[model samples]
Every structure is written in C-alpha cells, then in structure tokens.
Target: MTARIRSVNVGASRDGVGSRGRASAIDKQPVASVEVRDPGPKRGGLGSGVVGDDVVSRRHHGGSSQAVYAVAREELDHWGGVLERVLPDGQFGENLTTQGLDVDGAVVGERWRVGSALLEVTGPRIPCATFGAWMGERGWVRRFTERGRTGAYLAVVEPGTVSTGDVVEVLERPAHGIVVPRVFRALCGDLEAADEVLGARVLDAQHHAELERSVARRTP
Candidate 1:
C-alpha cells in the first residue's frame, strides 16, 4: 500500500500541560489543513506543521533536525491492541500521523515527498519525561524506549502546504543504512552503535553532534 498522511495535527504552547510546566504542542489536534514551511534560521529553527504551532522548549525540541515528527498508524494500532484501547492519531505528539509507512525502518536522510513538501528523515523522537506525563502511564518512557519503535523526526527540505490524506512518496533514500530504530537504540541504549549512523553524511549536523557526544562520553 502506498504510504499516506492520515492526519495533520498542530497545537500552540500554553500553560499547565505535560511535564514542561506549560501546555505542550505534543497534545496536537487534527486539522483540516496546515502550511508546511521552513521557519528559517532567523526564526530559531525549521517551522512546524502550522503557522501557529508552538515549540515550548527550544532547549530540547524544535529546530531543523526535528521540524516535524511523524508516527506510523500501524505502530499506533499495534499499541492500541497491546493496551486494549483506541490509539488516536497525534496521541504521541507527532505532527503527522502516517499510514502504510515503516517509519522506524526509514533510513536517516531518506527524503519523503508529502504533498508538495520534501522532508528528510533526520532522527528518531526520544521519549521524554514530558511524554510520560502526557501518556499518564507509569514507566511509559521506559516502555517506549525498550520497544525501540520511536518514530522519525523530519527536516523540511522543500516547504509547501500539506493536508490529511496526502500521499507520501519516497523521492530518495540515502545509501547509508542508518535506520531510525537503529539510531534510537544507539542513542538510548548502545552507545557503540552510534558510529554507524554518524558515518552517514546526510545526517543533520545537530543530530550528528549529539551522537558524537554520546560516543565521546562512553569512550573512556
């Protein structure tokens, strides 16, 4: 089946939500349409799904490397089955909820054509304390990390408008085999595995630096 966007969700930063001590855009709601664009360097990073979308914490979130986060509907379904509950799109705070895509298997630097925008897979979304709070489940972060199905973070390569049901086309895939799951495990579990992904030239500099730091810390 051809991969496609199931929903486009976005939200603004507000007070009293998540573990951020403020409302997080992580609680994204589906929208009919949203403008996708690079916010430009002057704006602090790549723009998110919609014009009013918020990036509450610039310290750890947002930026070109994580401009847009995407999660697979298949994974959501799997989780729903495991939890015996309905898992909705945007429940994980992803900007794009996609269908028919192996998001975790996508290699870093793979370019996806969604609507008119071109997006490059940059890295995986690491579950955080805020995510655990959002989920309202004990050990949610540990459970998510252990599963190693973290979704992909994308960087806008060609900005354009995107909407629900837009077909996602793979325009390019980097020769490097630095898939999302591998990177997530390397970042969160095996520090030694970081080298393989760092070798991928197409990886975003920021992400590369992060992996480098991880490797350095474990090199002693």
Candidate 2:
C-alpha cells in the first residue's frame, strides 16, 4: 500500500471524556479534510492545530510541538487483534490514520510532507489517565506503555490542508536515530535511554523541556 492518510479525524469538546470527569475531544470522527498549522505554545494558544478540532485541555495537550497526532493503520490493526475488537481509523484519537508508514519508528526531528503541510516528528504519545479512560480497558495505561507502540505526535512546520488519501512523504530524517518507541521507553523508566533523550541535540529543541522533565523525575 502506498503511504497515505487513510482518514483525517477531528473531534469537538465533549463531557465525561477526560480524566476526573473533565471535558475532552478523544472521540474523533472522520472528516474529508482539515487545515493544519502551528497552534503556538501549550498555554495561551489555540486548542488544536487542526482547525475545528477541539482540544479541551491545554495543560498538556495540543500545541506547536504537538500540532498533530498520526498513527499507523497497521499498529491499529495489531492492537485490534490483541484486543479482539475492530479498531477503526482515528480510534486512538489520532488526527491522521496512516497506512504504509512507520509512525513509531520515525526518528525525532524527521519531517514529512502530508498533503501540503510539512510536519515534524516531535515525540511519542504518552498514555495518560484521559486516554486510559477513553479506552476503558483495565490497566490500559500500563498495557499501552509496556507495549510501547505509542504512535507519534507531529508539529506542523508548514501550514496547509490535509485530507484522506493524501500522500504522506518523509522529506527528511535526523541521523540521531532516536525513534518514537525508544523515546517512549526512555520517558517511561529507561534511565539509560532517558539520558540519550536528554542529550540528543538532533531532537527538536522545542520539545526538550518535556524530555528533560521526564529525566529529572527519574534522576533521584
């Protein structure tokens, strides 16, 4: 299969979709197309980089460094088999459900041209209480983290439109070779790998804060 977006999804803010009964936009639905752009910093910025998509919480979701979320259809399928459920595109709250791309294997700072937008691989999606609640599987957070196929968070480097069936092309990759899954593991508890994450200059400097914070937590 060609590297392409199988679906573009967006969700509106909704009640009871977040941790502690807070609002969330996790139940994304397919859309024909959407516009993507930098949403500025996490606080005091637009909610979602994809226009019309609502990110109810800005505390740790949606921003320039996480302007978009993309997940591999293959990964979704694999999880579906393990979970014994039919997982649809965007079921994981990813904005783009992609085929024929290694979302988790993508190196940090790798750039892709999705439709007309230039997006950079910023980091992996970290499982959270909201995500666990959304999944409704017992120990969902722990299970997902342990599996470590966390997909990718992308930052829009060039504003443009994206649509289902649009080509997804890798334009560049950093030689540092730190991939999304490795980064996830590092952030989780891999102290040695966490050092790599903190020390890698090839990684996006804009996202270094989070990596550093994670490492700091495990430091002492």
Candidate 3:
C-alpha cells in the first residue's frame, strides 16, 4: 500500500476529542501538515553518519485522522502483509504510510526511499501514556512496551522529498541474523520469554549486556 502526506495537527489530541485542559495554556503549538521528506540541512543530514537526524519531533494522542501520512486501503493491505494481519483502514500513526514493507523487522541502521525522500529505521517506538489513553485502555502503554511489538523509528537518510502514494521497498533487514524482538524479549523482564529472546546472540551492545545480566541472575 502507498501513503500520502496528509494534514498533521497536534493539539493535546489527534482526533481533537478531549480538551488539553491547562497543558495548552503552557505550550500552544498547532501541529501543521508537513510534507514528509528528508528535512534537509535545516533539519538534519541523510545517512548513518548523521546522528542528529534521529530526533522525532511529533507526538500525537487520540485523533489518528490528522497524522503525518494518510493511507489508502491498498496501502493498508501492504502494511498488513508485513504485520501478518489485516489492518483496519487508515489505522497507523506513521509519517510515511508504507506498503509491502516489513517495518517491524527492519533492524537499526537500515534505510529506504519513499519517493525521492530517504527514511531509515533507527529505533523503536517508546510506549507512552497518551498512546494508552488514546487506545482507550488503562494499561495499554505498559502492555505495549512489554510486548515489544512497536514499529521502528525512521530517520530521514536522504533529503529527497516524500508525498502520498509512494511505494516503499525493504532495503535491508538484520543481516546480523539477530531480530529486534529478540532484543526486546531478552530485556523485557519476563524470565521465560527472556530465555527464548536471549537464546541467540544479539549485536546491540545494550542487549548483550542485558543477556549477561540475565544469565548472572539465573545462575544464583
């Protein structure tokens, strides 16, 4: 499926459902619809050499309608294939609604092109309370972080320019043979699952340290 740059609004909510209460009084910045592209030198550089491009500036709650990119049914199907599940129409909070791409399997430091703009998978989503609140679940954030299924974060690698209906291709997966889920599970604090996650060696330094800690804890 392909995704297009749609209007983006970040107020205390994406749906504009609930009031931001006093939060808006302090920091009142209306989220604007920005064309998804490599934000250029004004934003950052495009490559593994550019560490500053790692910053993710947007965070929205509820109202999924006004997001970075809006996906059509076909694009959703593409994302669903990667997810291994049929996704609801227009149900992603992505700046780039991608199709035929396994976004989750993308390991750290992989880049792909969306139209002319290049985006790279740099990190995973950090579960937050607002997301849980938006999901209408009290503990969704905890469960989400614990599950470690959050999609990876993408950094603009090449400052081309991205709009809607862009076809996304998988430039790379972990050639290291270690999956992201394995790292998350190994550090998820679930002993049984941790064992399975740590069953294999992970290249991430943080994960390797955690595995060592887990082994030490179990030994005693």
Considering every candidate listed, which one attains the maximal lDDT?
A: 2
lDDT, candidate 3, equals: 0.43
In order, the Cα lDDT scores of the candidates are 0.82, 0.89, 0.43
- Which residue pairs in candidate 1 have backbone atoms (N, alpha carbon, C) closer than 3 angstroms, thus clashing? 39-47
The TM-scores of all predictions, comma-separated, are 0.93, 0.94, 0.51
Candidate 3 matches the true fold with a TM-score of 0.51
Can you give the lDDT of residue 217 in candidate 2?
A: 75
Give per-residue CA lDDT, model 3, range 1-220, as digits (tens): 3433332212222333223321211111223223344333222332112211122332322111111222234544644675577654324344443444555666555556666666655444455543444345556567566646655455555555454445565566556554445445555555665564455443335435656797678765
From the highest TM-score down, the ranking of the candidates is 2, 1, 3
On the 0 to 100 scale, the lDDT of residue 158 in model 2 is: 94
**What is the lDDT, from 0 to 100, of the residue 73 in candidate 1?**
92
Error of 2 at 38 (Å): 0.4
Q: Model 2 over residues 1-220: C-alpha lDDT tens digits? A: 6799999999998898878887889999999999999999889999789999998778879988888999999999998998999998988999999999989889999999988899999888888899999888889999999889999999999999999999999989988999988888777779888888878854456556766877777677
